[model samples]
Target: MPTPVIDIDSLTKVYPRQIGQPARRSLDDLRLRIGENEIFGFLGQNGAGKTTTIKILCSLLRPTKGAASVCGHDVRTRAARSCIGYLPENPYFYEYLTPRETIDFYGRLQGLDKATRAREWDALSERLDLRGIGAQRIRGFSKGMRQRLGFAVALVGDPPVLILDEPMSGLDPLGRRMIRELILSLRAAGKTIFFSSHVLGDVEQICDRVGILVEGRLRTQGRIDELLNRRNEQVELVVSGLSAETADALARDALHARRSEAGLHLTTADAAAANAMARAALSEGGQIVEFTPIRESLEAYFVKEQAS
Candidate 1:
C-alpha cells in the first residue's frame, strides 16, 4: 500500500478551564489519512478545530491524546519538522525587509547555501510576481502580496507536505485565482497539500479529496464523487407553470422547491419520488415545463452539512 503522508489516529485535544466550568474540548477522536500528492481540503465552519489540528500535525502543539505521523516521522520528533511546510492564515513578514531579502533569510534558516538561496530567489521572485516588490519593504505590500511571500517561505524548505490555513482569505479575486493555480501546479509536481478554507468553490475545484468537520467532529471525508453519492439525492427542474399550491406541497415534502424566473426548482432526496410528485402536479392541472435535472453541487452539500 502507498504510505499515507499524514496518519492521524484518534487525535484529541482539550483545554482546561477554571474550577467552576467544564474543560473545553477542541478535538475528539479525530482520525484521518492523507495520501501523498493529494490536495486535501480540510473543511469546517469557524471554530471547528481546524487550526488546532494543523498545529498538532506540525508539532507546534502537542496533542492531548493519540498520535500522528507525517512523512514517516513522529510529529513530536524534531527531524519531522523539516519534512513539512506551514503557511498561516495571516502571514507575518518583517515590514523592513524586501521580498527577496525575506525569502533569502528564510532560505538560510532552511539551511540553503548563499548561492542556492540566490538561485531560488530569482525563480520564486518571478513566479510569485515579486520582481518589482522584491526590493521594496513588505510594510507597503498588499494583502495578496504578503500571502504570496508567505507561500514562498513555505516552499523554501522544499518539503514533501504542505499545511496551509486559510491561504486565500485576504486575497483579491485575481490573487485567489493565482493561489488556486499555484496549488494545482504543486499537485502536478506531486506535492501533498493539506489546506483549510471557507472558500467551498475553490475547494471543490482544486481538491482531490475533502474532509468536513463540524463541532470538532469529522462529519464526512471522501472523494467528491463518493461524498455526492452519500448525500441526499437531488433533481433540479425548470418547470413553466408551477401552481402556487403544487409548489407549496412540493416544498412541504422535505424537499427544496423554489420558483425562479426560468421555472420551478426542486431538490429532494428521492429522484423517483420527486418525479412521481411532478406527475401528480401535472394531473392537478400544473403545467409541466422544462424538466432539467440539476445535480447537487459541492456548495449545496456544504450548506446541508452545516445546517445539519
Candidate 2:
C-alpha cells in the first residue's frame, strides 16, 4: 500500500467551557489516512465539524488531544507546516493589489525574494489563466477570477498537499468547470488534495475516495465504487395491466413497491424475490413492463447512512 500523505490518528479537538457552560468536544476521535496523490473528498452538511477538522489539520487550531501528521511530518512541528497550503472558503485578498501583487505578497511571507516571487508569479499567472488580469486590482475580479488567483497563491511554493474548504462555493458552472479541471491537473502533478465541499456531485466525479463527516464524526470512508458495491441491495420491478386488487396484492407481497406511470414500482430487499414477483406478474394477467436492479447512488447512500 502507498504511504499516507496525511494521517490523523485518534485526533481530538475540544473547546473549553466558555462563560459558565461545559466544554465542547468539537471533534471526537477523528481518524483518517489520505494516500499520496489522491483527491480525498471531505463531505458533510453545515455544522458537521468539517471546518474544525480542516483547521486542525492545517495547524491553525491546536488539537486538545491526539495527533495529525502531514507528509510524514507531525503537525505540531514547525517544519511540517511549510509543505502544506490552505485556501479558505472566502479568501480575502487586498483589493489594491493585482493578481501578481497578491501572489507576490504571499510569496514574500514564504521568504521568497522579490526576483523569485516575480518569476514564480509570472509562471503561475500563465498556468492559472490570469494573464490579462495580472495588472488589474483584485477588487474588480469576479468570484471565479478570485478563486483562481487564490489557488495560484497557494501553489507559489509548490506545496505537496492542499487543504481547500469549499473551493467551489459561489462559483458558476463555468467557474466550477475550470476548478474541476485545475483539480484534476493538480492530481496529475502528484499533489494530494484534501477538499471539503457540500457539492456531492463534484466529489463523486473527482475524488478517488471520500470520507463522510456527520455530527462531528466520520461515519464512513472508502473508495466510491466500494461503497456503492457494498450497498447493492436494491431491486426494481415494473408491472402493468394489473387491476387495483392485483396491485394491492403485489404491493403486500413485495417489501416496498409503489405504482408508477408505466406500471407498479417494486423495490425488494431480496433480488431473487423481486425476480420471482416479476415472473408471477407475467404468468398472471398482469404485464411486466420492466424488471431491473436499481444501483444505489452516492446521495442515496448518504441518506441511508444518516437514517441508520
Candidate 3:
C-alpha cells in the first residue's frame, strides 16, 4: 500500500455553545486516509462536518480532539501547510485585484519572489484559460471566472496535495468540465487531490476512492474501483404505441413496469432481456422510445449509506 499523503486519526471537532444556540459536534472521531497521487472524494450532505473536517485539515479551525496530518507533518505545523494548496468552500478575493495581481499576491505570501511568481503565472494563466481576463478586475468577473482564479491561486506554489471544498459550486457545465479536466491533469502530473463535493457525478468520474461523511462522522470509506462491478445491471426500455394490454403483457417479463406519457417504462435484469421485450413490443406495433442501461452508481451507494 502507498503511504498516506493525508491522514486523520480520531479527529473530532465541537462548536461551543453560543447565545441561544446549543453546542454541536461538527466532527465525531472521524478517521480517513488518502494515498499519495490519488483522487479522494469526500462526499456529504450539508452540515455533515465536511467543511469542519476540511477546516481542520487546512489548520484554519482547531479540532476539539484527535489529530490530522498532511504528508507526514502535523496539520498545525507550517510544514504541513506548505505541502497543501487549500481552496475553501467559497473562495473570496479583493474585488479590485485583477487575476494577475491576485496570483502575484498569493505567490508572494508563499514566499515566491517576483521573478518566480511571474513564471508560474505564465503557465497557470494559459492552462486555466485566464489569458483574456488576466487584466480584468475581479469585481465584474462572474462566479465561473472567480472559481477558475481561485483554483489558479491554490496552485501558486505547485503544492503536491490540494484540499478543495466545493470547488465546482458556481461553475456552469463547461466550467465544471474545465475544472474536472484540470484536476485530472494535475493528478497525471503527480498531485494528490482531496476534495469534498456534493457533485456525486464528478466524484464518480474522477475519484479513485471515496469516503462519505454523515452527520459530522465518516460513515464509510472504500475504494471506488470495482465498487459497482458486482452489482446487478438493470436496463430500462421505454416503448411507445403499446396498448394497455400489451404493456401489461410486457410487464410480466420485466422486474417492474410503469405507463407514462412517454410510453411504457419497463425495467429488465439486463440488456438481453430488454432487447427481447423491445422485439415483443415492436411486434405488437409499438416503437422503441428509449433503451438505457442503468448501473449501480455512486449516488445510489451514497443514498444507501445515508439510509444505513
Best by the TM-score measure: 3
Candidate 3 whole-model C-alpha lDDT, 0 to 1:
0.91
Considering only N, C-alpha and C atoms within 3 Å, which residue pairs clash in candidate 2?
Answer: none
Q: Write the per-residue lDDT of candidate 2 for residues 1-308, one digit (tens) a residue.
A: 47888999887888899898898887888999999999999988887888998888878899988899998999877667777888888778999999888888889877889899988888899899998899998887888888998899888888989999999999998888888888999999999999998777888889999999888789999998898884556688889987888788889988787776888998877688888887778777888787777777788877787777
Off by over 4 Å in 2: 20-22, 230-293
Q: Compared with the true structure, what per-residue lDDT tens digits does model 3 show for residues 128-181?
A: 889999999999788888888989999999999999999888778898888899
Off by over 4 Å in 1: 18-22, 230-292
Better of 1 and 2 by TM-score: 1
The candidate 3 region of ten consecutive residues with least summed lDDT is 224-233
What's the C-alpha lDDT at position 109 in model 2? 76
Cα RMSD, each candidate = 4.5, 3.7, 3.2
Superior by TM-score: candidate 2 or candidate 3 = 3
Each prediction's TM-score versus the true structure: 0.81, 0.81, 0.85
Each model's lDDT comes to 0.85, 0.86, 0.91
